[model samples]
Target: MVRWLLVLLMFTGMADAAPPSLYSLLSQGQYQPPMQVMLQLEQNYPGVITQFDIDVQNGELIYEFNMLDPDAKTTVGFAFKASNGSLLEQKVAKLESDDLEELAAVTLMRQKQLKFSQLITLATGELDAYLTEAQLDHDLGISYLELKLLSAAGRHKLAFDIANLRPLPLLKWD
Candidate 1:
């Protein structure tokens, strides 16, 4: 019984410790705001930001953005230094018809009253999950929030509708 009690205490302590928020990280000078990086990219190629996520690549934090250029009908991917927002990599790809369809859907969904921070809080509370990565994407005329979570079960991915915050099942593994 004593051993079980100790184990429970340890688990409880772990559960009480939530991961730091993105804003806090920014305040600490760890990573630049993804929106800021996206805006810098837009100066050269005006487009709609379809995806934004922070990732560790090559042993450093990389802020990545995927933008849909309506005028060119192409998708541009940019990677920047998380700490300073310096451009590190850029790739431009031809957008497919399906991609455009999804973009339209995402644009419409974002017109609603949902905020990104609120969605992040809801996801963390629901799964007892730590946010590892986040992405905004559209599929089949639906805008979705993709979150990579770190939990006791290890890393898992989840999706939710941006407009309604409804959980979505994993359709495919990437």
Candidate 2:
């Protein structure tokens, strides 16, 4: 695991020589850019680092990373400059998810003819939204809404009845 640790250290820690010309970090779900990574990126690249934005596009192994205008909320897909923080190679992609899937807990109440394939797609969408919206930013186990969304697709029924289970307020995923 020493090699892994070294790579992780490289995320935020200083390089023995210079900023990595090209680099990558581990991510299974949400790509929370570690503070150390940002610091090192800034130190090595200076003004080019700019701001980091985290997002998940389903059906993908890696999350699509982006830089944003801190004030304007403008998004760019590629490199920023050390000279002036100008975003470069900014090719705009069409979309992440075009399907209308929702994770709202109320989805369980709907009994519809959504296909098995369609169900998984919808459930995945809802799961993504729920996880991103939770106060803690993640839930280890499936909750009422997640199960319900799945049920709409015939994957699984709402296992536990959540009568009084009000979901906590959504938290900002920093």
Candidate 3:
């Protein structure tokens, strides 16, 4: 249900006018950059941000952050208004065993002291696409940065090997 709503919004007229870049929005002085919003969220949430997304609904832009709380064994999602970084809503879900494993992957990355914001910027700039979502996942000791992007052609799914900072094959959804 939520997926469908997000897909619908992607095709709506309002989403068509999304800014070309975070800097564009900054130059306009209309909305806070995603990085700043992310920093603020980190200060308040005190967890590892596992995912981030940009969404449009009701003609307003929203920045969504999904955080993993290792101590609490839960995942919390926060939605913030893009214009001013005002938090709109928050939802929490209990973590399962699989989630704990994922948490371990996140913890390993944390120990390495790697920053994902740089990768986000690189991926978006390289593809010349609007990044809609980014998530961290690991399998068989390999950590991947999964990204969803919208470009002139259509939606695209991309994966980057976090260890090497190399992008894998690109998958497009028309």
RMSD of each: 10.0, 17.2, 8.5
Q: Positional deviation of 124 in candidate 2, in angstroms?
A: 29
Error of 1 at 153 (Å): 7.1
Per-residue accuracy of model 1 over 35-146 as CA lDDT, tens digit each: 4555566566666666667776544667777777667778888888988888889899998876855466446544664444456566556565445576666766667777
lDDT of all predictions:
0.65, 0.29, 0.73
Q: List candidate 3 segments past 4 Å from native.
A: 1-30, 125-127, 170-174
Ranking of all predicted structures according to TM-score, beginning with the best and ending with the worst: 3, 1, 2
Residue 149 C-alpha lDDT in model 1: 63
How does model 2 score by TM-score? 0.19
Best by TM-score: 3
Clashing pairs in 1: none
The number of clashing residue pairs in each candidate reads 0, 5, 0
lDDT of 2 by residue, 1-21 (tens): 999888987986664564321
Relative to the true structure, candidate 3 reaches a TM of 0.69
Report the C-alpha lDDT of model 3 over 1-174, residue by residue, as the tens digit: 988887898888655665455434434557787778877776767667889988766656789988887888889989999898898999999987767655865786677666567667655665666667888888777777788876656677888766676776543233
Cα shift from native, residue 152, model 3 (Å): 3.3
